[model samples]
Target: MGQLRDRLMRRWTTARWTRRLGAGAAIALMVLSIQPGLGNVTHAKGATVNLVMWQQWGGGHEKKTLDKYIGLFNKSHPGIHVSEVAVTDNTKIVSAISGGKPPDLMDLGTTGTLGQWAHDGLLQPLDTYIHSSHINMGAFVPAGWHAVQYNGHYYGVPFMNFNVGLVYNKKLFRAAHITHPPRTLQELDTDAARLTVIKHGRIVRLGFVPDYPASNLEVFAWLFGGDWFKNNGRTSTAALSANIRALQWEQSFYQKYGRSSVKRFVAGFGQYLTAADGFESGKVAMMLDGEWNIAFVKENVKRFQIGAAPFPAPAGMTSRNGTSYIDTNPQVIPTGSPHAAQAFEFIKWETTNPALAAEYATLVVNLPQLKHVPQTSLFKDPNFRVFENEANGPNAHQLPQTAISSQFATNLGNAEEAAILGKSSARSALQNLQKMTQQEIASTH
Candidate 1:
């Protein structure tokens, strides 16, 4: 799915729905240059595996960590050399595969890209080598593995996982003289009101931004006894209507405080976590963000008393408790890499090693992906355990890992922006979006 992902990146990042899903069989193809010299290393001296891995974070620390992995790979397997390069965008991976110089392995955070690449013939299947080595994939969560499969064929190996939580400002709550965090839905609303502040006819402090990132709608819907798509627990389109819940939630906030006031208050805010970041500046009381923010906020904000809790439903609402969401960072071996054997070895050693996982997780503030990484006293922060347990729990689902995931997320985000802005009625907005989504999915098949 080289070009497919390129188009997806364009759509997903811009929140545009794709217009075409064309499949023409028996297209012109360039055969792989079968370099027996490259694949055959039995008698070769120090055969090197050149690798390029892409991830969202691209600072020097992440670079050093990857360098460490290559260092270890080279140290143990002197005969099998490894070279590492880091990427900021997965689009580069697209270029490499289509250009026929694809990296030996890719770490795309889950099965979606792996499945797409494999379906597009960019990825080579790993089942043969996996069975031969008897690799125990049980250590990784089910969602990543499920994402890696396409019609029973596994194309990638998973690396890590993470979950979301309701992070709040504790100092502000205490300043408001509220002693305890909300337990029930009603109590949360009451606490929110007390925590919020208005200045000069503008909301300087917002209780919560229910529609932030739009992905929260899915988690909230799941928590509030709403299903975006559920057929006997097999499928989901939950994000679409989370916009409805968001609209209702936002509309309620608007009713309590006029829409004009809410708009002006929101408009004055800066980006999510930067200097103008509402949470970082204490302008927003509560938000739904992922596990990495635990370390990030601790490092960035010095004076704020930060705490986290599972989001709650309104008073007397009967829905599942602690029903949260997971945003995983999974790794996969691409389908058409020239160095498949070396790639598998690298992933097997890295993923299976508890020590390295703990180290990386520390830097990123996510739970160790390994089954054996212990939660020691040093790592025993309250919300840290919450994220870890949720990641490995029954509710942990690697977000919809479909080949069409980019489209779904974009459409859902669009629906969310529209709903929050009151550009269209909530029901009509979703109905149009779902109809469009169905059309897009059908075009693909």
Candidate 2:
């Protein structure tokens, strides 16, 4: 949700948990002492349900938006009052949950650990709540909804979702005499060669860099009709032929442009979200990036006309033209929350209420998880429309939901990096990844 991931995934070590648990205990005691009535009251009619919510991303537009929502939520639902704390350290959340004093509402910030936390009994299942509340399950974007599920149950609700596509500078394309975004991998290579500018054997501008901005193995693999898991999420499929094909495709870039030369060219790129960002500054003609980049480019770049389209499909995979990788910022209630019912009410209201959901989505500039969002004029901008369309497209997918997902993402990302840098052959890297992920899954239990 930010320029870079907020925190690195931490190992689930006992010593680490012990330290966090101690701090959680201290924090719980202090909170109880200072505010004797922080928990939810009786479920009687008109009784106020006070909720303490700890969120992951805060202190800017995110904070402002959440505060606005809380204000609106509290005003409309007179019986529920929400107090939010900006929480950065995920270990503190685990500590609080482990110590049995978790917040009534938790914004889990990332989708990668949803399955892991749910399997560990750190989250409360919402199937019963959804059924009882008559929540319309089909209203959510399919991929975003899938991200909240694990082992046949939904553990959370999607807060906001994102899907990545090919973002290109129209000015650069015009300069290269390219009329449209490439629709196939072969065309992409031809366009990239035309758009790339080399001076003195050094790259002054790059046409595209697959792994730049973020590790995008998942995106490419999906485009190539590959996935990391199968057998209903019980096994690793990193070594699939399609995955190897994706890796070799990424390697072609490094192979075409010398690895060291490309490395040196990229090393000069500015920090993401800044004026000198590779794409924003027009130093890179194209990249695989999310919908947020549209707003970012509008704010930081003045001379370029930025456009978004589904990443080019592998040759002859015309059906995969709209394929994209989707992920979410999910919200969940901890297993031990005393205000589970009240929390569910707030969650459902915030996520499904069309008025509130639209306002929040507009303010945050994120793709609303709800299906109705695309029809609304709130996201009438062409760039937003492209992403909204892609989010609802049939080919959209999310990574597998599994207890070892964090490790899986890390390993596959490393495998992608290795193959791209020529540190390992694509087949060999994928084989290693397959073995490592299988071991992770085995160790998870």
Candidate 3:
């Protein structure tokens, strides 16, 4: 009976040992699974990584086109799932980042904003990624490459490029007995004066209005051999003589056509997107606009006859004929993105793959930043050719990359408006703008 009891006791001890071993093993596994960067424990092959992207192109066909490409990317990359969210207001993005929940990828609509963000240390420097992917920085147009850079570090990738050009009405030019588009600033001014039509002391049609549609001080300033900054964006040049001259030139339009009359005439125009656009309806003969205008004209005005030309330069400065305000929307990764490497992979694929790049640009009717993509048949249409040519031109430039770039632009706009409205002389307005921009720069530092 004692021998039988010993056997039963031994069996009980063995059972208890087995249970303890099993529990210990289970605990180990639980700890391992929670540990980070352990292969198979934290992330396994074929495991899905979800990423979110925020973009400004959320309306109309832009949204549809972006979604189509995103869907294609997801299908092509089974392990990576990218969900797109449309966020047009940049302030929202700022708030998200400050809250430590920024999207994995963001498409800020201008390089200026990208520069400001990068300057604030809110972006990831892409040098390592660029080197790992063997991206040829020279493949991008010089202006585009310049746009995405700040303090010698690249924080964004160029997506679509657009430049200002002189879009004119061919029918109107022919009616005015002008055989060719103006080649110089003087010619443009003379053409505009001749094209101006006054009916019974009321201006019926205007040939050109400098501040119509939108006022871009950079456009006019660049055309007149002036820039907002000097010494590689280290100093404000708002009060320089060249910029003053540019503002005066803009004010001349209001001076020539009484401001009150011009204001009343401008009020008569309909919204820009509709068929009654001043340029489309023969109310304005010439204007400085971007490549996207082609798509707008094609969609809205069926019978419109238009001609695209390099924006004219000052007469003696003929070299600036093709000089334009080249702008780009850069794709960026926020600083705290968990899937930065994956986001960059996507950006490299989208920007470097000629076929995909061309497809995206074509759908949006924007110029592809890739040198070869612009040569594709999709961009060979005459309406887009002029912009493509200008993209390669020598004088294409982006706004200066400064921390206060947006504020600087706003101040310049205010100065231009003040000058145009005859409230202040061009010199005084620019001087005040320079003082304000300087103060902003100092405060930011």
Candidate 4:
């Protein structure tokens, strides 16, 4: 009886061992089958960090180009995966950060907001990252570097730079018997007067419109040796003599061509991106715009010969000759971003890598922030060369880095419109702007 019981126990143990072996073989086969899929997973096991990059560039071409470069970055750095989100409104970014769910990286349209955000303690100073990454700050253009700096600290990396140029129609100039583009503001006015045409008691075409496409108050203010701030951007200088002169000069155009007529003409104009653009449609001969117009003209208006020149300076202001106003779309890491280090890694790559920088600039038709990238063949093309040269020139100036810069710009625009429409004198408009700007500056403090 004892021998029979031991034989039964042995049989049970053998059955259990056979089942275990069969289960182990099945597990091994399953693991082998899934081995080929491991590499396909972007965030597998070893030291992978995912980041989110938020930007306001939601236009079709802009988003497409940005995504292309982002894909390239992801393919090159397997350890880091960056997801891009197009948050077109700045208020959304503020709300997200306030909600503690901010993106790791952001492409704020212009560095004008850097001061306000930095002052509000919403931005992380990138000095450490800039130094640790061995980034040569000198490699960036002065205007770009200036735009990103606030209170003696760098808060962002400037990715693209753009300056306003005098985009003109060559055919229009020839028809007006003008052989050369204006080199001074006085000459520009003369050209405008000469090139304007009137028929049947109605203004038919304007030679140049200073505020067409958009109102660039800062550019005109700078051209007149003025700015919105003084004393290292602590005080409002909106009512300075130079700014008043700039406003008066702008008002002169509307004064010469009846304000109602100019307004009616502008109202009748089409959107800037479409083929019906006033400048492209030969309704306007010249306009003060950025380099992106080169791409727009190429794609939308192909029937004319387009030319670009430096925005002429005030006569006798030789120092302002070749002057251009520069603005940049800088990449910043929010204060509480969990992936700040990884975000900097990508910023470093995008700014320092020549090929990537050039490709981005070319794709967007904007000037590259990196000094070396402008010398590439893409920027040297005839349509783009004028802007490239003006960007590299000594007279390129960035907007004043004030916490209330956007507000200041808005106030100036309002004042400009009022003065140009003959509703207020330049002095009164600017004085009002000064009061408003000062109040805003004080409130921020």
What is the lDDT of every predicted structure here? 0.62, 0.80, 0.79, 0.79
Model 2 residue 268 CA deviation in Å: 3.6
Candidate ordering by lDDT (highest first)? 2, 4, 3, 1
Candidate 4: how large is its RMSD? 14.8
Per-candidate clashes, comma-separated: 8, 0, 0, 0
Compose the digit string of candidate 4's lDDT tens values, residues 215-277: 877778888898767788878778888888998998899989989998888788888766787
Model 2 alpha-carbon drift over 4 Å, by segment? 1-50, 56-59, 99-101, 302-304
For candidate 3, the lDDT comes to 0.79
Clashing pairs in 3: none
* lDDT (10s digit) by residue, model 3, range 1-445: 4533543464357665575456457557453232111111112235776778888773366778888888988999888877787777665676455434467788887776776788777788888898889998788777777888888888888888778789998989999999999999999999999889999999999999998778867778888888887777777888888889988998898999988898889889998746687888889999988777776676678988878899899989998886777878788998656568888988887778777778877777788877776345657677677888887887777776778777776787799989999999999999999899888887887
What does candidate 2's lDDT look like per residue over 183-205, in tens digits?
99899999999999999887999
* Cα displacement (Å) at residue 8, model 3: 52
Better of 1 and 2 by TM-score: 2
111, model 1: CA deviation in Å? Answer: 5.2
